[model samples]
Target: MTLKAGSILTGTIVNITNFGAFVEVDGKTGLVHISEVADSFVKDIHDHLKEKDKVKVKVLSVDDNGKISLSIKQAIDHKKSVKPIEIDWEKKNTQNAVNFEDKLSRFLKDSEEKFQDLKRHQDSRTRGYKKNTSH
Candidate 1:
């Protein structure tokens, strides 16, 4: 089976590393990056995958050096099919209407004040140097 970009391929997990997993498919081995392993953060790769485990992965890219990039999350159909709940924004917050520009300006002023306060505290902590008598 010739591996191409966007192609779904079944392969065996040959090795696992801190960065990714090496999978062999159609006589060619590819890497599935940690981010591509699943839809969520993978603290430990061994928790999600193991050697000799058969996995269906989607080919993301075929680099010029012939390295194949794969994504197991993309291969699996995990899209939400349920309809989202629609919210009536205007009715929900009619009484508490606030201008975004005003809020942003206030936030910037607050941030600047806090930054100045921190700078002053830091400068005070530094020992005051005496002026040199010989110049």
Candidate 2:
């Protein structure tokens, strides 16, 4: 069978080196780079993968020489479906109402203070204008 990217296939570890492990998959062979073996740090390939051991591998790339590169990490990291969290709509609405009320009250109080300051400035200007025009 033709192997494609993201394809998961069973393979036997044929060779283990300091760099990586060579795996035979579906009559074809590929190299699992040392970095693509596991999630955690691996000092040695022999510490994680063993010779003649069966493992599930994901096809990573194919070279010009038809040399295929595989990854055991990708296969292990396939995402499983998970249900989304449910929220309490009633409680959320109540909390939102309280927050909205607090914010609106603060805004109104600030606006009233600004208006009072503006009226005071306007009254002072009006008095100054009257005094100049009267003289």
Candidate 3:
């Protein structure tokens, strides 16, 4: 079969090196660079790959020289439909819930009471020091 870019192919590791690994696909050879061995850092290419190991690889490129570049990490499919975590903010059925409207009303009432107290204190302080009313 003809190898093409962005195509996934099954291949066997023919050789391993410190910098990369060579794979044989459809009787044609390809090189899987150490950086393409995985999505993470690869300190030693041999630790992640070995000779004669069958692996699925994604075709990165095929140059004019017919030398194919492959990626083992990109071959596997990672597309999964995932939903965000849904949270119940309020217990509508429960009687113990503090509703938004109720909370707002309570806050307004408390603010009014505090304002009245502050006004009373200011009035009391002013009462001690009377202002001249005669023009």
Candidate 4:
């Protein structure tokens, strides 16, 4: 079968290397780069695929030298068939309120502790002043 550009093809993993996988489709063979193994980050290609595994790949480019560049990302359907994503504004507002309240409570507690320390210092100073004045 002629592997045309932009066409998705299914092939068996014949060989695997650190850089890419060699897939064979019918009599034709192509190289699927490690970057084209998945839509997300691929730390290791072995995590998603292995030799003798069947995988779907999309042909991205065909060089004049007959080199075929393939991508697994292109094989994914990114179009959302669902309705528009509506943010839960009310829930978000309530969550924000809860977060702000927690922060405010923490701040108030810190301020109260500082105020109490300051008041204690002032009272001590007042007592000292009274003793000095009396003496």
Candidate 5:
């Protein structure tokens, strides 16, 4: 298959370095950068990949010099997109009905209490200032 940007391809990791991994796909070698290895932070490339390991990679770009940039994380994300998300509408609606009211009530109560406390503090300060000024 012709490799192009956004193409997902299975490749063998022929070499690994501190910066990235070299993957051989369709007889062409491409670089999968460290940041593209996984969704999470990669402190060490060796922890995520090894030489000769097969991995699915997404073509990010092919420069004029024939350098291809690949991403393993994008390839994995693309595969995940194939699966449909299942939602329990009944359960979700029930939970939202109950939880939203409770959460809103609690938030309102807390806000009111804070407002009252701030008002009381300001009032006391004002009264104290008036008394000093009068004397």
Candidate 6:
């Protein structure tokens, strides 16, 4: 298969280095830079990939010298975008309503308890002041 820019291809990790991993695809090898290995920061490439591991890579560019630039993260993102999101509308709506009601009731109960505590504190202070002034 001809490897072209933006094309996603499956390849084997032939070698791993401090800077990147070399992947072999269709008898040709391409470099997946450490930064292109994953979506997040890759402090160590070995943490995410191993030699002989199969990976999907999106071709970033093909140089005149046949050097190919690839990105695993972009390949994953492309796959994710191609999939359709599934949701049960009825189930989600009922669950959200129950959660909202539970949260609101808990908040109201806590507010009322705090208000009562403050009222009691104020009443006690008023009584103490009255006793002192009458003396």
* lDDT of candidates 1 onward, in order: 0.90, 0.89, 0.90, 0.82, 0.93, 0.91
Model 4: per-residue Cα lDDT over 1-135, one tens digit each: 677888988878888889988887756678889888877788888888889998778888778888877776677666853367888765557787899999999999999999999999999888855444654
Q: Report backbone clashes per prediction.
A: 0, 0, 0, 0, 0, 0
Q: For candidate 3, lDDT tens digit of each residue in 1-135?
A: 788998998999999988899999999999999999987899998788889999999999999999999999898775643356798877465543557668889999999999999999999999889789999
Q: Report lDDT (Cα) of residue 73, candidate 1.
A: 90
Candidate 6 per-residue lDDT, tens place, 67-95, comes to 98988998886665677889876565778
Off by over 4 Å in 6: 78-135
Ranking by lDDT: 5, 6, 1, 3, 2, 4
Q: What is the model-wide C-alpha lDDT for candidate 6?
A: 0.91
| Candidate 2 similarity to native, TM-score | 0.58
* Top-scoring candidate (lDDT): 5
Report residue 29 deviation for candidate 1 (angstroms).
Answer: 0.3
**14 Cα displacement, candidate 2 (Å):** 0.5
4 or 5, which is superior by TM-score? 5
lDDT of 3: 0.90
Lowest summed lDDT window (length 10), candidate 1: 92-101
**Per-residue lDDT tens digits of candidate 5, residues 18-105?**
9999999999999999999998999999999989999999999999999999999989865656687898766557777789999999
Clash list (residue pairs), candidate 5: none
* Regions more than 4 Å wrong, model 4: 80-135
CA deviation > 4 Å runs, candidate 1:
79-135
lDDT score, candidate 4, position 28: 66
Clashing pairs in 4: none
Candidate 4, residue 102: the lDDT equals 100
